[model samples]
Target: MPAPRLVPDLVPDLVLDLALTVRHDGKGGIADDLDGVDGLARWVAARGDELAEAGAPLGDFVADEDALTAVRALRQAVRTLFARAVRPAPPSPADAQRLLPGAEALDRLAAAAARVPVAPRLTWPESAAPEITYVPTASGPPADLLLAALARAATLFLASDDRTRLRACHAPRCVRYFLKEHPRQEWCKPSCGNRARVARHHDRHRVESAL
Candidate 1:
């Protein structure tokens, strides 16, 4: 039997969930269609992907085929920004604008996401000391604020002993995040495991037939 996926009590889990919501097209790659991938992961990954590629960090992205190069560049930037949970502070306003022109929406969000706390610091770092650590009295805080808050909260709450394990699903087409199971669970689940097994089987059969 497959083990259950690890889902820590992230006050507001964003990056992991958001990145997982991609769907596979008939071809072997991600598709933007939200039909199949709509769920918790979808919601978060959508926000992430929005900021990452569509230039809608504050949830104001508009979909248009206006420019291919610009769109691809935006996505690459997003990926680079969120690759590390503990990234450097958001760029200065001037730098943000320089990195993504006319993308004030995402620039603002990137600044916010970059603020998420990632360390188990006892006292606020001199840098973070100036920042107001806003804890939400209400749930479902704005995505940007939620991400920042979660980062700070986690930093405060976690211990050096309290481990934060990151796992990527083994599925080739899926870049989803999952918590590490209790000494088990290599793939995300039986479904993904079976699908991968079948894919390997078909390839092996084809190769044998050719032989």
Candidate 2:
């Protein structure tokens, strides 16, 4: 199994989770979680249970190499878009264009949405299982369904109030982004905070030693 996430609670949106597929090492380099099809498959599997609960299961769809490539591209676009959005200044025209969903992407989402099924259920007893449940039969290509789900996540995230709190980690060489839950929260997790503090301490000592 892939290693458990270092900061599980930081992922508030699926789009943000997708963007985190690539992370920075704080040593002036970055790491790619979805390095290839296998890497992508692992990433998807890691979230399989959560997706299933959300009514969007992968169901062997991650085996497609082309789908992996497409997902990677979408992740990069989401990162670029959010990076621009969180900056103090307004995003340039080119950046906005990169952020906007293209016609092809929009068409794919529309087609997939049309085929997606809706399952509703009602619980009879509060403590026991639901007396009546409807499990919708899934339709459409799995790859397309995955793409459409990501597109929807991106759209929903953009419209949410949490967008205002979205932030990229400030630690040296750390490229992870997160939704700021607290006003003072900066780094994505405690480890990043410690790393940043150590880097700062080293910088201060080096400057003092030079003097």
- Best-matching candidate per TM-score: 2
lDDT of 1 by residue, 1-211 (tens): 2211112333224343333334445476555432332332344444554332211233432333332223233333333333332224332121223244335435644454354322221334666532222323333323433344323323322222222444445554544445556676656667767877888999999999999
The clash number for model 2 is 2
- List per-candidate RMSD values in Å: 12.6, 7.5
Model 2 agreement with the true structure over 1-211: per-residue lDDT tens digits: 3222212222255677887777764456666878888887887787776555444567867466788877776765666667655888443222344454545444543444344564545545777644432233566676766665665556446555667888777776666777778889977889989989999999999999999
Candidate 2 has a TM-score of 0.69
Could you tell me how far off, in angstroms, the CA of residue 209 lies in candidate 1 after the best superposition?
Answer: 2.7
Best by lDDT: 2
TM-score of each: 0.42, 0.69
Off by over 4 Å in 2: 1-11, 25-28, 53-55, 89-138
